[model samples]
Target: MESRFLGIAELTDVPDVAVVVDVMRAYTVAAWAFARGAERVVLAESLEDALALKARRPDWLTLKDGPPAPGFDLVNSPALLRGTHLAGRTVVQKTTAGTVGALAVKDASLVLCASFVVAGATAGLLRERACERVTFVVTGGGGRAEEDLACAEYIARRAGGGAVDAGPYLRRADASRSAAELRQGVREGSTPEDVALCLEPDRFPFAMVAGAEDSLMVLRRVAPVDPPPSA
Candidate 1:
């Protein structure tokens, strides 16, 4: 049972478990939404797919990149979800690299989204499930970013039962090119506040599990518990 770290481009070789990380905003926001009481999250690879899902189920919350749409309740910014009531709600998340990486792991038996918010919990879940081969996929800024790589390293360490000093990695990530994208003018709908939220480590206490139920991909929270053995 060894856990390996990989980049977004090398997603062909899936492992027993694929842990996708998008620290800049996508997975961080998802973690926050779950902590705030979101029932389930649906990850969509494209904005069109999210829109189609939203059209069919008008009650589900849809989040994506760019400026806030007319009907969409929120964007991919973690700072915007504060104080919102998400209980009993389903959120459809469509991001550039995060959700796309998640959807690309066709060979993985289990898929989970990871961020600093849920790093420890994810590691615990993997141990509980006894997944021997795990791959930490850093979906870095559509190419490769320091933040995602740093997050992957931290997660790998935690999952391997090792104590990790994440300060240096987080500092590097804060100064990385991807962190700059969170600045107000760097990308549309991106805000400086998001950068602050994404860097906060261990902010949540649950791991996010992505599973297919009734042919629909869904994200659900995995609390700290002894999980059953891998299927």
Candidate 2:
């Protein structure tokens, strides 16, 4: 059976599985931090809460920060994550879209953190695992942005799924035509090269497991022990 969509607004609807994205920065930085050897990354919806968590667990090696989308701390930009050495540490990150949406849908049977950084590989992993349904929570900067939607489209397409339509949840959400958004992302220093990089689709097959003593969720490539039948 093929996978299908629920609704964007139904992010917290408790589906079989869901992937929360903050690829521009929150999720992106999480990936970079893990790649830099950080032990794990914790995604928080609030700066104060993340800070408090870090304070409570200083030994966990937590670094509290996230994207700034107005009142937020950091913006979701790949440029920010570059050259950061989080090796053997943990991070407490707060993002406007990715974090909020993720928290909203925290009740899912399986919640996977994703973005362009791990999109393709994530698709394969989900397919292999055979999740009955998968939802993409776009975290639209208090709504939903075109960049996130486009990224979602690519992921949904890659998964060889989309039996359910999510347009209803996106009715009030803002989106740009893929071409225009891509161009703007490039002109704004986001860079077409970065887009290409994120488009690698699951370059990292890492999954974040919550509730572990490891406060930080690092990207660890997952090897499917039971290989699926090749098409």
Candidate 3:
């Protein structure tokens, strides 16, 4: 197996498997939503697209970050999602980084979303598949997002047959500018719990996999046959 890391701009270069990382909040939020029992998540390129999808499917919930939008049902905060009941419901998600990066990968046989919370599981799934070529897409700021880049490297290392300690990578992610933004968001009414939640490596036992369905990118959880030993 061969694995490499790429930025959002290089998503088109993704090969057999594409792993999109957005550790600060986007992919973390998606993992939490799935953990909370969401049936599926639809990746939207923008808030307008999310709202349009919601309008077409009134029962689907729309989630996004930033200022409250007219049709959004929820904010893209894992802390907020923790209290909501999403069991058996479909979610339409739009974010500045994660969702866009996820939807941009056009030719991969498999697409996965990753964060510290699901890093080990994502890598485990890739190993199980015996993928020949894998690319980790750092979705935040076209790879300038340090947290996402660190998470991508961590996953790539693991997928490439390395049993490494996650401590250093987690520390790097915590010290990133995105982490600082998350802290600032907490002071502005977002929950502090999000900071802690986003940094918990391998918190989930399943990987989030995305499959193209018509015009939507649908994400579902897939547990690896053999989970990797704790990092």
Candidate 4:
């Protein structure tokens, strides 16, 4: 098995299995949504697309960052989502980094969304697949996306049969620019629980695997088969 790290710009170069990391909030919110019983998450390229999808499927919920869009259901904050009941419902999610990066990978046989919340389960899923080539797509662009990079490295190390500690990576994510932005969002009346929720490593036991349905990228939670024994 081989693992390579790439940025959002290299989405086209992803290999057999691609793990897209967005530790600040995107994938973290996704993980929480799934845990809250969301049926499926549709990846939208932009806010316009998300709103359009919602208009078409009136029952589907719309989730996006920043201010709420017209006809949108919720903002992209896991803390807010924690209180909502999403059972048996579909969600249309449009994020600047995570969903866009995930939808842009056209070649990979399998694409998984990653964050500290689901990192261990994601690495477990990769190890179970035993893929020949795996690429970690850091969706927050590269140099400035410390949280995403740290998550990629942690997943790679765990997928490679290494008994690595997640403490260092979590610390790195806590100090990232993305984390700072989330903190600022909290002060501005955004959910104060978001920063802590995003940084909580291994909060979920399943991986968010991306698949196509009707030409749309959809994410669903998948438990790793025969997960590695806990350290």
Candidate 5:
């Protein structure tokens, strides 16, 4: 089995398994949402699709950009959803990179979303499944956000059987262009706290798997299987 890291622009051929990483916010929010007991999180490819889904199902929470709107219950902020009760509830999210990258890999046999929260388990799952070709897609904030690239590298390291301390990488991400902009907008909506929260590595033990549910890409939690004890 071979694994390769590719940015969105280089996604020419789909692999047997595709892992999309958007550590700055998107996948981190999903991890936190599930940790908070959300029934399931749906990944919307665009704002329009999220709104359209919300229009049809008023019970689902729609989270997007620019602070929580009056009618919207959430945004792409992990800190924002940390205290919210998501039990028995579904969240529909549309983000700039994560969801788009996830939906773009339509040809992969399996699709998973990765972040620092699930890095170890994600790697374990990949090796367990033994896929021949695995691709990690780094969905940068613009062309190649610094944070996402760092995250992609970190995930790749863990997947390739290496130890990773997220501290240094997280610090690098905090200094990235995306993190700087998010900090600059703290008063407007984006917060440094959210950026801080998303950088914590292996915070959760479960990996997020994405699949089509009706017209939405729904994410479900998958616990990585433990290996047999060494002889």
Candidate 6:
């Protein structure tokens, strides 16, 4: 069977072994955070809210984060996580889009995170594992989008053992309009390019696990099956 199709906006859906796509940035940012040696991350939609969480935590908590721009230390760029630059840093990043989406799915079943970088891993995890169902939730601008929904459809197709279909989402399952309507108004920035990296299959081994906090998720770095070429 196809398991089931769910589209919730929060992490409580993790039990469904949900696939959360912040294709615009949050999911992408989470990818960069883990790539940069961030042991953990507290996702926040608003910078004000993210900083407030940091205020309560002790100094032992190393922190780093930023905007969606490339110059910022924590912009949603996976390229930013390259080399030995972030050997021992734990980040607490804030993005206008992806973080907010993560905040929305705080109660999901497994809360596996994705971007262009970990797409293959996401699909493999979904297919090889046994679960009740899987939800494909994309945050920012309802649900329809150029990249997010395309990303979602790509994933859903992979999980369901269907053919690889890269066409845009449609209004009706049979409509000509490409792409779902929920992905409208997605944020525009370097986030898209970052998303491209997330689209690549099995490039890295990292997944986001939601913590008890409202806007935070634990980033666990999985052991690489093969040597990553000079990331």
lDDT of 3 by residue, 124-158 (tens): 99889988888888888777788888888888788
Residues 76-190 of candidate 2 have per-residue lDDT tens digits of 4455555666677766666556666666666666677766666655566676777656777775544446556655665566566443343331332223443245446643424
**Model 4, span 1-231: residue lDDT tens:** 687778877655547788988876789888888888899999998888888888889999998877765788878888888888999899999888888779777457999998988988998998998877888888885524889999888888888775788889889988887778777764332465788998887888999999888988999999997544334
* lDDT winner, 3 or 5: 3
Question: Residue by residue across 88-187, what tens digits does model 5's lDDT show?
Answer: 8899988878888898885688898988778777777776777567888889855377787777777666666656666777788888887877777753
TM-score, one value per model: 0.91, 0.67, 0.94, 0.93, 0.90, 0.65
The lDDT per prediction is 0.80, 0.54, 0.84, 0.83, 0.79, 0.51
Q: Which ten residues in a row have the lowest lDDT in candidate 1?
A: 222-231
TM-score of 3: 0.94
Error (Å) of candidate 6 at residue 25 is 2.4
Predict model 2's lDDT versus the native: 0.54
lDDT (10s digit) by residue, model 1, range 31-83: 98897789999988678888888999999999887789876778888887866
- Please give the TM-score that candidate 2 achieves against the real structure: 0.67
Give the TM-score ranking, best first. 3, 4, 1, 5, 2, 6
Whole-model lDDT, model 3: 0.84
Off by over 4 Å in 3: 12-14, 186-189
Task: Give the Å error, residue 99, model 5.
Answer: 0.8
Off by over 4 Å in 2: 1-12, 59-77, 141-143, 161-231
lDDT of model number 4? 0.83
lDDT of 6 by residue, 1-231 (tens): 143333344334345456666654556556666676666666555666555655675331322334343223344455445443555555666665555555566676666666545665566566556544766666545555446556666666655554454333322221312112212314333333343454454455644555555435655554423322211
